[model samples]
Target: MSFEILFLVIYFVAMAGIGVWAMKRGKQDAEGFLLGGRSLGPGVTALRLQSSSMSGYMFIGAGSMGYTQGYFSMWYALGDLGGGILNLSVLGRRMRKLSQILGSITSIEYLEHRYPSKWIRLIAAPVALFCMFFYVLAQFIAGGRGLEMVSGVSFPVALAIAIGVIVLYTFLGGYLAVAYTDFVQAIIMVVGMVWILVATLMAVGGFTKGNEAVGEINPNLLTMWGADLGYQGQWGVILGALLVFSIGYMGWPHVVVSHMAMKKPSVARTAGVYSLIFNLLFIPGPYLVGMFALILLPNLANPETAIFEVADAVLPTFAVGIVMAAIMAAIMSTADALLLQAGTIASQDIYARFINRKMNDAQMVWVSRITVLALAIIGYAIAAFDPPAVAAVVIFSTTVLGSAFVPSYICAVWWKKANAVGAISSMIAGTLVSVLWQVSGAPDATGIDPMVTGILASTAAMIIGSLASQKSHPVPEHIGRALDETAKIGPIPKKMLIDQDALLASQAEMAGRHE
Candidate 1:
């Protein structure tokens, strides 16, 4: 077998080994299987979060974009960094706390609880399912493309191998296995990226030579500015991407699931900071590799394959094999997480809540595992058949979450007047506006991001709806209790720790206080 084929086989075996090992460790119950028994520490959480966030897009698409667009692609890293910083400082703690308060092991549950809207929950269920499935589809597609690129195999053959490896580990081991494996993959990704960058740079005689090479071909490609970039090449695009990406962190079911696995709010808080540190490496990797490719190989048949072409040109056979494995690792790390989140939401939110809430923990665990396989198969089929607009797919999902939930979440955290009517109105309006904006081709026409438009409209709906329904219902005391539990800084006050019994007791105490 060629080195590439050999590496592919080894990568598949190693991923399967992780699944088998995690299963042997007895992650049998729902909590154990789904959230790693709620025991992930700062380091594990940080690495897992970073790897999952980068997904296939950072490894493949961003690299391609960087190579094609030059320094314009670096703006993506800056945007992600800004988002990470804001999420840690502003939204991270609140989300962790609210997840606990609502007993929300899933993003759908969190949205439902925050809004107290049945319609919101109902609508969000299918949206989460579709959104995550599509996200997973992208991963599968990228994995297939990456494999086919390196190995010169048929796309279907490569996709099947990639999908099989991911499904075997994810279905058997669940989130615990995924997180641990993601950490391993994260290290591999960092090493692979740095190794390739260094080798590529040395071959080109450093940044100065690299820039001259690119400038000799196309002068604009050597600089931060570009012809088609418009405001996108400017600081506004950077800041907008950062702001949009950062605010949407709470919306991604996979990322939010990481927070739910934390044993305590403090753990999530610490992990938030740690997440940023690891992300520093991943966020910049594409820029370095992409920019380097631009400088080295100024012309290509397809810009998206720039990384692979560069690897083929500069790296030895053995090194190319390693980098190919690293790319596969990135795709698997992300695909498993996406698959897990989709399965969890499908089982917990849709199946368990509406279909059958009485599912035992063991039964639920089995269902979730089954859902993992089902979702992965769906992802694979889509990957095999469908081609999508990659950036649009990501932005569409983010916009769905942002417009539908951000207003309600913000109000739930900060505004006492936010009620169910407001929450429901915001979601319906937000989702519609976003969908319409996307369908209307507004993003292409006005150069305004669809997310910004939908969010603005949704925010207005939430505020107006809340004010109009002010007399309907006041903020529940449980929301305040949830907030206190999340913040984890106040005294172990009476309002916190609100189980069913504690809720009754708090109500009685409040009644007495009124008397």
Candidate 2:
């Protein structure tokens, strides 16, 4: 067999083996399947979170942005350099402690407990699922495109193959499998990008020659402000792009869930440092490689394929396969996390909580598997319909999640008066504004990112709704105590620790006492 095919076969087999191993090793409960029993270590947690956060956007979508917008695209990298650090510092340890204290296996469940409102769970779960579906769809599209380019297969067949593998591993092993495989993928993605970047620079006679070549085509390609595309030069678009990668990292349930799953809350402290280093190494390579592609393959039609084309042209066959697999790794790492998140939301939040509250561990696992498969099929169908560019879909979905959840999430942690009314109103307003902004033509119409609109609207709603409902819906004393305890930088008292059953009983007892 050809080297590319051989390498891919090995990679796929290795991934499958990990899935089988995880299925055997991991716990069988819903918490285990969805969050790996909250036992992931620092390295694995950091890499997995980084891999999922970066996604195929770094390889394909970001590269395309570099090729199209030149140095302007570096704004994304600049914004993302410390995203993981910011995320962990702001919400990681506290969220982890709080999730366990409240018996929250999913982010939606956490929101429900934090706000003490069924309405919050009801609205938040659906909105999260909606945003995540689009995110997963984008990853599916990236997978299809990468496989079609490397394997010489039809997009549909490649898409099916991608979905099938992702579903199998995610269904069988769940988060543990996803996390371990993401560790491997994270290494591959970074190594491949760094290798490609160094080789491409060497081939083109270093930075000076590279810049000269690009300068010959159009100096505009090398500019900071970039080509004038109506709103491209505007501060809003630039700041929006920055915010989407920086602060927006906090709102992603898939990424945020990582904070809830680490072996210990202290893992976030170390993991944050590791993730920052990984991002620093991994983020810039794709953009630089894309810049190199401008000098090497100027006439290439689809700039998204710049990385793949460069790999094929510059590297040996075996190396090419490895790089291609890394590209696939980027896609799968994100796809698996998004798939798992969607499945967890559906099975845990929707199925067990709303559909049938009596689901046992075994039944929940099976339901989660089925839900993952179903979501994969739906995402595959959406991908097949020729969606927007990978970066666009990713950014749009990130913004939707950020606007809808970030305000509520921040308030849940810091604001004692953030009640169900404020949380629900913020979610509804953010989601509605983001959707309407997109439907109205996004930045082209307003020269500001849709995320900005959604965030502003959501923030306003939170303030107004909370004040208006303060008397009617005061913060629960138990939730307030839990929040204060989690906010402290130490272990929760053993006496205060409780499992799901005990948590429910305590809540019931508290209600009785209050009544």
Candidate 3:
């Protein structure tokens, strides 16, 4: 076998080995399977969360945007750098404490506890699951494209192989396998991308020469504005890009779920610092490679393949295999997490909580695994038949999820007056406005990104709804007490705490009395 094939074989075997190891050693209970027993240390938590947040979009879509739009595309990275910090600072510690206090293993479950409304859980679960399915489909498309490019296999066969591997590991090992593999994959991604960037820069005679060469073709390629030199450089467009990734982190289920799984609230501080450093190193390299591709493969037909094309042209066969594996790592890391989130929502939130409240730990575990497999197949099928533009799919899914959850998520932890009515209205309004904006071509017409509209609308709805319903839908006293206790900085005191068991028992008592 060629060195590339050999490297891939080793890579695939290593991933499967991790899965088997996790299955044997990792926790098998529902909480352990889904949330890693809330025992993840700072380093693992940081790497896993950062890796899961970034998909192939960082390498493929971001690179392509750089190649097509030039320096203007860097705005996305600028936004993301601050976004990681914001997510950790604002939601990380608080959410971790609240989820544990409320005994919420999933984001939807967290919302249910925070709002204490069946309608909120029902609405949030399906919406999150649907958006996450599309996000997984985008990753499948990215994997298929990478596999096809590197192996010269047909797209369908490549897609099948990609999905098969992801499903096997994720199905068998669950969250533990996903987190550990993500830690490994995160290293590979940074090292590989940095390698490709350095080699390409050296080959093209460094940044100065590369820019000159690109300038010769079109000077606009080096400008803050894109080649269009018009609306693309507008402030609204840039602001939208910045806000989407930066503030949007709060709403992402797969990303924010990491907060709920950490070993301690303090882990958020350590993980935040580490994740910020990782983002700084990882986000810029691909976009730089995209710009470098301008000189290296100027005539390349598809800009999105800039990173792959550059790597294949410059790296040795064995090194090429490693780079390809890194790309696979990027794609699969996020895919596994997304699939896991979808499964957790379906089985834990929808099935166990709503449909069959009597499910034991073992039964829930099996249901979760089966749900993971089913969702993977569905995502794979969508990718196999007719995949939309990967960038468009990613942005849409991210925007929808961000719009639906950001306002409510932030308010649940911070705003004492935020009731179920406010949270539900914000979610519905955000989703609806975002979809309508996209369908109406408002972004194209007005040069404002849909995310901006969605976020603004959602925020407005939250404030307005909460104020309007203050008299009719008062915040529950227990919830207010829990929030007050959790808002403190230090570790929660055992004496002052209302543990999950007590809370559940009290809720049951209230239900019995009402009935």
Candidate 4:
């Protein structure tokens, strides 16, 4: 008990230390603070990107899934192992190049710049905030529940403690702080996962023995059909599980911000390699740990805490502290990024774009900090009053965010015909379909995941809407040029990346100019 408490205290101090270090580095200007002056090293960028997207999903949700559904949970892990690198390889360079061309500091700003639509920012910003808020709430729930169990405190107090620590550090440091701290937390998570997995394998007499034991308990646990063959013929469910993490990262505003924060467009390639290596090492450990626990600790009350319980059973008291701290660290790392991106979009995308366009650096920072506080309050209220399972909230939020923006984001640099009408149509249709599909319980009924349906709806909207409205809403000349540059093979000349016209183009009229 004392060890867990001590490690928790130590972890908080370390995060604060990183925050203070970031503050002292003197990148307090709005641009520097928001995007780390677009100067992240490849390693930091890779890990921060992965860590932000990985979140409590891996620590809590993935384990819970493995423990409950058995081998089917590996489908998510397989997709996740490549999601980060896939995102970087496809969008990293293009987004970095395009965002710099348009002077976009936020992902919402990047969309508006690419599609040349004020409505895109107006619509996308709110949807992003709405989705990301739920995401942060999931992290809060995961952390709060963990703390509650470890500290024997009331849920409200434990939640307050978790959110309080995360909020304090976030308030102190800006983007760099979030990135560096996630980088550090990613390292801790990898080490702890590897340590715990090895311990589990040893305890169960090896992977083969462990699986045999699980099969003896329930033969279905060893199959890809999920425990009891519940999803025996549900290919749609299986596909959704795979696609959720794979392509979802490309569309998430919070995760994609890492692209815009790269030091240069060329950093994307190196970052991709780093991402894949990290993913390969860390992505499957939690699920495997959870699956093996079907034999070792078969009676856990909450499957979400499978890793924690397994650690407590297998590891020494000190190692148990480190292991739980790693899970909490993952929760906090992801929460920090979500808060930073949500705050960035709220202050820069919505506020500056519409409400107060002339704010200075200090004012932007102040507004952002306040916005972070507001989001934390909103998330706390939602989570404290009616918290759902971490996995459910994460999947719904991921589906909405991914569906709402995936097609538009991909088309921003890739499709020359992508215009304002199409982007707006895509965003609205995607979000509407995603929400309706989930609410209607279509996934269980029809076996089609909201993510698949949402992406399909959004992509079709982007294609059909842009084509139908081409004469009235052709892509702006400057944005087309930006897209051309982004599509090129190698490092683009700096002069070509950012031009005055691209920077100052009026969002209201850029797409409508040709008409």
Lowest lDDT 10-mer window, candidate 3? Answer: 496-505
**Per-candidate local distance difference test:** 0.67, 0.76, 0.77, 0.78
**How big is the positional error of residue 347 in model 1, measured in Å on the Cα after superposition?**
1.1
Candidate 2 regions exceeding 4 Å error are 14-45, 90-103, 172-181, 229-233, 257-268, 483-515
Q: Per-residue CA lDDT of candidate 4, range 397-417, in tens?
A: 888888888898888878899
Pairs of colliding residues, candidate 4: none
TM per candidate comes to 0.83, 0.85, 0.85, 0.86
| Best of the candidates, lDDT | 4
Model 1 CA deviation exceeding 4 Å by range: 14-45, 101-103, 173-180, 222-227, 232-240, 254-271, 361-374, 377-381, 480-515
* Residues 134-236 of candidate 1: C-alpha lDDT, one tens digit per residue: 6777777777777778767887887887778778757554433543466676677777777787788887888788777767766666555552446443443
Candidate 3 lDDT tens digits, 124-146? 98888888887888887788877
Give the least accurate 10-residue stretch of model 4, judged by summed lDDT: 499-508
Summarize candidate 2's per-residue lDDT along 1-515 as a digit string, tens digits.
Answer: 56787898887777667666767676677765555524667777778667766688888888888888878888778877746666545365556556666777567877888888788878888888898888877777787778778888888898888777666656554434644556677788777888899889998899888878877777777776674444345887888778787767678775444333333445545566677877787788888888879888889878888888888888888899889888877777777777777777777888887888998888777776787777787877777757578888888888888899988888887788898999999999999998899888977766888878889999999999999999999989988877765565445464333211222323543464448
Cα lDDT over the full model 1: 0.67
Q: Candidate 3: lDDT of 470?
A: 91
lDDT of 4 at 404: 89
Weakest ten-residue segment in model 1 by summed lDDT: 497-506
